[model samples]
Target: MDLEFMEAHLPLYIEAAVLTLRIAAAGILLAFLTGLITSIIKYLKIPVLMQIVNAYIELSRNTPLLIQLFFLYFGLPKLGVVLSSESCAIIGLAFLGGSYMSEAFRSGLDNVAEIQTQSGLSLGFTRSQIFRHITLPQAVSTSVPLFCANIIFLIKETSVFSAVALADLMFVAKDLIGIYYKTDEALFMLVSAYLVILLPISVIASFVERKVRYAGFGDTSTVSG
Candidate 1:
């Protein structure tokens, strides 16, 4: 490994990593909101909207992020909707991540017992009130592991932002490799950059997951007590 070359190129990688993180954070936030709303719609089984959400989930999950980015950055301009590359990247990541997040949230929501909901209903709690006060908290707690996994997955998916001309870490690495032929140095920096970003998140997520599990946050039986 060329330590000198790695040190020289570190700033480029850092800039790219920052861009990547910003894009990932925006995408992840949008995805979480989208997932939460869609999951709630599914849970409530709203007639027309439920079918639409189901189709969106299926389409988003079934397609590759690359294809989605291409459609956003390239195809949309043909239809008179011009989007910047960064916009395309964020939208595509959200489009892809939202489906996965929806599934995670839906799984959590499903684990809440029907009896608990019924008990709330009998106590004169509105449906929205029950969800806000009881269901949402338990479901979110139960789904922490899944949420962490999805966030990591979405961050990694930002690698494809290069396809939309975003100067993400993957783009910088590939550019350096193509221009300077320093494949080893470029790849080493890329890996290290990702490790810096993801390692702490992975460790923290594991710690939080263990804490939630130990606290019995998702145990359906505890609902009665």
Candidate 2:
């Protein structure tokens, strides 16, 4: 173990850590939005669209991520789906996140009472209006915290982008190991980098979950619990 080399390379590792954070952040945000939309599509069972979204969810969640990256980075361009590595990570993460979010959102929507939609329709609200005013709000509040938990998950998922040679944290760590042969140190640094990116998200998710619980998802009273 070259302590000197490790010390000399700390800055490089930190830079890689920052890049990893950026990648994870971008991917998680995109995934959250995409996932939310797909979840709604599935929950509503929108004719042909719902079935497509269901298939997408199953496919994304069921596949090994390494294969997905290979397909996106190596295979897709065979059919002309070209994207930079970082861009591909965002797209891939969003695709997978959307699929998983659909399941989370469907569960949340199911938690809402069927009567709520009926009452809104009886009050002469259009289907879209009822969804917009009555159904969606409750569904979103119910799902958001859970979705936030998924954000932490999605952040960890971003580490897999190293397969495509994305300079995410994992890639950087592997590079360092290759250079210094301090495999343990490199692996430790990688794990620490992931923790730094993910811990705050978990904490924030917990806070939002508390807020949602207080909002009386069950009560449906004033917006405040």
Give the number of the best model, judged by TM-score: 1
lDDT of 2 by residue, 186-212 (tens): 777667766776788788889888887
Query: What are the per-residue Cα lDDT tens digits for candidate 1 across 54-165?
Result: 9999999999999999999999999999999988988998899888999999988887878768889999999899989988777877888999999999998898888888
Query: Would you give me the overall lDDT of model 1?
Result: 0.90
Q: Could you estimate the TM-score for every candidate?
A: 0.92, 0.84
- In terms of lDDT, the poorest run of 10 residues in model 2 is 215-224
lDDT of candidates 1 onward, in order: 0.90, 0.76
lDDT of 2: 0.76
Pairs with steric clashes in candidate 1? none
